[model samples]
Target chain A: MTAAAASDTAPLLPAARLRAALLADRAATLTQLYRRTFPAVERHVRRHGGTAADAQDVFQDALIVLYEKALAETLTLTATPGTFLVAVSRNLWRRELQRRGQHPTAELTEAHFDELPADESEAAPALAVLDYVQQLGEKCRSLLIGFYYHRQPLEQLAAAHQYGSVRSATVQKFKCLERLRSAVRAAWARTTDLLTA
Target chain B: MRPELTRLQLIEQHLLGPATPADASAWQLQTLLDPDLAADAAAQQQLYAGLQLAGRQQLRQELQLIHRQLYGPGSAGWLRGAAAGLRSLFKRRFRR
Candidate 1:
């Protein structure tokens, strides 16, 4: 992917270019922000139960959140790139889950979990949670993976799954858990009983 | 032979570890973790091993996808969708 070849074909749709084309006064700041923060946002959006479609949507939304916050010029960085990104991704996921009326757990954005340093040693080996969740059916697997990994609220789960409400979706959550359990068992070459842990 | 447990029981222990007094008394999950099931420890270990393997692989693939999406002209597993759009644009004659 050569940038020259890319520009030769289509204008860059990057944050830097988009800010330069659309906004006033904050172009340089936006570019620097894009360079500094966009990667973290992009990576988290990709892994946090979003498809490329979802990834693009979440990344853009988080950027907008940052943009709006920059009004105060206090969008400080208490956490590293990964934590900030995962936090935003988790919130977006919760909102998406809520819209669907599922029971997304408040546990989705566990501050303690996010506060942990982003050590490659502790980071799950996969490139992104999205790719791992891809191993399952998109609709079911994605929602389940969202809950499994991020604890997206049940209301959000229902919305994402299109269930009637949180309770109805809760049953599905159990089922989703069963499915995840099965997946882990099969992948591990373990029997169903062994999943008891 | 290993014993069976409910989804809730499994999840509680899987993510939270060991039966809480409340969990054991209320759900009767205490007996579910039978010592006979101890024989199945290998399976439990295997499940964790698999989850980690799958998780890491997924993460690797996703990062690659992001990398391509950012650096390349197209997204992962989605270039085919763009090709047709691009083909039509090529047909739109710029001023001769």
Candidate 2:
């Protein structure tokens, strides 16, 4: 079956919903684009030491850039969503690398570049920071992961994880997060020492 | 556990976050006054960051699992169903 016939939904807005004469819209086009492209984007971001949360943020940001370009008629997505996002994430990652006094030509040409834009070059430096953070305990890990990385709301997290209430979840999430930040800060401090040596 | 501030109380300030609208001025002032409480708070922040990183890994795996279940070979029944539905539609539209 064609992608246009797939079960995808267009989020209807008030004024847009009233426009019946123009039923030529294919919601699946974008939905299909999201589904098809997101996996590659996620893989690329992850390889760069991005977590699922980071991938989501990168994908969303990449799409937002694409959307704005679409509105301006300057965005032509000849590459699939996966390729486009990988390219964008790579660009962002390279900039981040430069900020850390590192070369921007590492791990960018790994497996994810089968059909990528021709100039693929560097993995993001955020990976090392993420790696260090992954060592915290499960509860703290879950709480911070859900809120900051997954961007999950406190109330929803409370319900999903069976906390007594939103307040409890919020407190728990913060406690866990405190652990993560301290870990990162300490790790960074150590890295600075290594750099100085 | 510090005598001045319980673990839960310290957690509350963290949830309040650094720049929240809750205006956690009192807690900030307290943190400023107590060096030990401040150190514990800093440690908690580090732990929380690590947790956030771990959580994303879980989400990625979960998302992948869900995708596989949706589009796996086991769920290919939808293709046949779609074919039948298409056949019926064409048959009705062309019927005399």
Candidate 3:
């Protein structure tokens, strides 16, 4: 079945509602969002010589970008999520094609491209830092990610992590941050040393 | 805590803007006295940035799982039911 036809019954969600659900990282909202937007992404990918698998990959990446932007409260949606997703998916497909030394046959308007998500490459440095953070042990990873990234409260973090109290959780969180900071510094120093040497 | 660890905690408090004026001044003085501490402060900032990326990556993984559960082959559950609901809705409207 055509992607467009599949979404006939699924209505476009209000931007505010979609943003809230995304920020909360709700699975039900995300599933409904996928149903509402994936069709547009798939159609765009297919028209551009991508297969279903390619469409899925491109759409998933786009959704992740959207999730990041929404979590940061930075997404400003001038159109419905479908339109936005299609725009972002198109950008992703274009980059994918370029990486393969191919070009999109269909031209998108400058306005359309402008509304799409920022270049994924812009996040490469931060992504690289994350590559290091993942190498940290599970406790460090969870503590840092929970307090800093997820913005979990110290009391909840204490109970979840089985810390003695909020005070201890706060101390542990800072220590994990210190560990992460030291690791990042060491990595940076090594890279710079390599470059200069 | 060791002096360095206490200093690190103080820097953390300073950066997070909850450090008292006296503590902030002390952190400033400490970073000034030791270039290494200044570098640590900068690394601390980058570490926070990395933490943000890590957190987002975790969320992305969670979202990916949700995607797999809903759309993966051999999947049967509420997601499948939702799909079926949509198909029937479309079928009923098309029958009109």
Candidate 4:
């Protein structure tokens, strides 16, 4: 079956509904996506001499890219979600091979080349700072994440988190952000010192 | 509001929102004159990037959990049945 026809049996989800389900962490919708798209990714990876575990890793990263694009309201699908997922998975797997110093047997088509997401070279530093986020205490972490990443409205966040008012939640979010900024600064300084030492 | 918090808000607005050209230029001038403000802005920008990365990481973990539930040895009965059907179909189509 063609990649577009791969997930034909699974009901197609509207892009908006898919975004909402992902943002809300709806398990059933995510399960449907996983069921629909994963097989193509697995087949592609296996054809390239990669293991099932490698396919899983590449598939997961592609989903993360898709999720972030949806969150940013920047997802512009020119094909079925299954096709898009397969293309992205192929690109990610190719990049992985290159990173491992293995030449990919399959050349990336122009379409696949354009599907690559953001550069991950900076991800290491960002991930290092993410470790500091955990040290900000659970309340702060949740407040910042709820506001920034989840994009929850301040009024809604206030009610959900038991703050007295939206203003209170806003204040708390700012404070949490400040704390995180300080931690990141400290981490940068430490890294600099280590490099210089 | 505390001056620090106010400055933080200004930096956030400059980075994350549509600042009027006036506001943007003013911010640029402020950062140019104030090294500390520039440093704070850079750090805040990195923090935003980190938050984005963290969000993706959290979503990946959630997806991984779903994947495990669907494919792991203890997957639900109906899911296992469906998977078996799909596997057979793949085998048939991909057989050399």
Candidate 5:
């Protein structure tokens, strides 16, 4: 999308604006999106037999799913961002209710649920591997997060992290990823060995 | 650089999508001939997945920080009021 088009339409809604902001260094836009979108999510969860804490948890999880989709370049909302968030939050809460052996209200149905581009099952391993990543060193931790998750441009990333150049930063990022890869590989091996034993 | 790390850097370039068209085709041919390279490529994909998880965790923390800032101590907003209302309701029920 052209920068002019993005800028012109950004203030229209949080959902439409979030994609552009996330692709660049625009934290203020993110904050605005969160603030504007979250209250509706909270109201939805609360009206559906959930507490404020439950709303917070559900909203955070939904936001994570939204962020992941945005990063993967696959999030397209049919509704406004707030409405989309409410639908996701409702689906998540219904699932939570089912898991707890409580019946979800008939009001909550899949008709309004936006089809996620990826399956929850596919996200399983991504959520599963987070525990292993926490054990990585500070530099490796930050480097991987900055490069892969945040999508920081290499030039800015190098300057922020004080790498001599983009090439060095790129090399360092790969090295950090390699270290994380090995650690995750080792952890999987241990789990497999335990399962087989 | 060791051969293995060099191979990883090459895979990273491919995964990151900056490889020249010719270079990517060459790497594809190399993967076809070399099982080890293919295996490493698959493993590298998994590594990217893991990194995505790491990134999500970082973003979650940052967001939760924002949540706290918006609703934490000394804050008075709709969210804070909502939270306080819930706390009192739960507190009253538990006290009974």
Candidate 6:
């Protein structure tokens, strides 16, 4: 089938379904999103002096932003999911241009693109925190992420991790969180010290 | 629950919850009166935000794997396969 025909027949997931897919990390739905939305992002990026590779990077970051919003349960789609992805890609590419000290192409006017909400601006620091999360060791990392990120219940986590009971799992989760908090605080302190020094 | 764990749970509830107005008010008053509690609350809030970021990171990795499976070097996608074939054909012809 032609690309257009394929897209025409593609199942467009509704907003709730999209959010659910993101929350569950469902590969099929996410793959469908990529197939449906990426071409438009690629075209827009190429038109604005970006390579296919640039488009890929911007599109990936946009998806991360969308995923974050979904995790926060704050995703409110104002248009088709494809259009939202394209708009986010546009914003991201525009930022990339500014970072590289190049003017955005005239076609990338502010009027033509949607400004992402302020919460999206926290992405960079959040990524840094993600690095800290990686340092939290495997057990703590899994426990914390399973609870907070995956939203898994204590009983389920207990079964998966072989904890004696839900109570033990809850205690473990609390301890892991405390460890994470301490580690992050120490890391932040070191960073702050470096800045001062 | 232990006192510290109970406090942590309260802070978590305030940060991410199910927190009732009364619970919120109590949390605010406690944090206001106790600087350490306030700091702990902030750190806990940051942790939740970090968890969301980590979740996004995981999802991004998953999407990237899907992208590679669909379009990367060894992908079975027809366009990429055709492009690779054409490139090799040109290289072979030029080298002759």
In terms of TM-score, how similar is model 2 to the real structure? 0.42
Ranking of all predicted structures according to TM-score, beginning with the best and ending with the worst: 4, 5, 6, 3, 2, 1
- Tell me the tens digit of each residue's lDDT in model 2 across A1-197: 11122213365332222121111232333444456676776787688766665565555545545433433234555654457666876675545445434644543222232222211133223444467556767666666665554444566578778999988886676555455555677777898999999
The TM-scores that each candidate's chain B achieves against the reference are 0.45, 0.56, 0.61, 0.66, 0.66, 0.64
The interface RMSD values of the models, given in order, are 8.7, 6.2, 2.7, 1.9, 2.3, 2.5
The digit string of per-residue lDDT tens for model 4 on B68-94 reads 787776768357768889999999999
Window of ten residues with lowest summed lDDT in model 3 chain A: A107-116
Maximum-TM-score candidate: 4
Q: Model 6 TM-score?
A: 0.68
The CAPRI-style docking tier of model 6 reads: acceptable
TM-score of each: 0.37, 0.42, 0.64, 0.74, 0.70, 0.68
Fnat per candidate: 0.03, 0.34, 0.64, 0.64, 0.69, 0.63
How close is candidate 1 at the interface, in terms of C-alpha RMSD after superposing the true interface residues?
8.7
Query: What would the per-residue lDDT of candidate 5 be over residues A92-140, giving only the tens digit for each residue?
Result: 8777666556544533322122343334356667655666668888877
Error of 1 at A81 (Å): 3.8
In model 6 chain B, the worst 10-residue window by lDDT is: B51-60
Off by over 4 Å in 2: A1-33, A36-106, A109-144, A167-197, B1-28, B66-96
Overlapping backbone residue pairs in candidate 5 total 0
TM-score of chain B of 1: 0.45
Q: Which ten residues in a row have the lowest lDDT in candidate 1 chain A?
A: A108-117
Q: Choose the strongest candidate by DockQ.
A: 4
TM-score of chain A of each: 0.34, 0.40, 0.62, 0.70, 0.68, 0.63
Stretches off by above 4 angstroms in model 5 are A1-17, A23-27, A77-79, A98-132, A184-197, B1-3, B13-28, B77-96
Query: What DockQ do you compute for every candidate structure?
Result: 0.06, 0.23, 0.43, 0.49, 0.41, 0.41
lDDT of each residue in A92-174, candidate 4, tens digit only: 88777775565445432211223435444636766777888867798888778766776656766787789998888888888
CA-lDDT, candidates in order: 0.47, 0.52, 0.69, 0.73, 0.70, 0.73
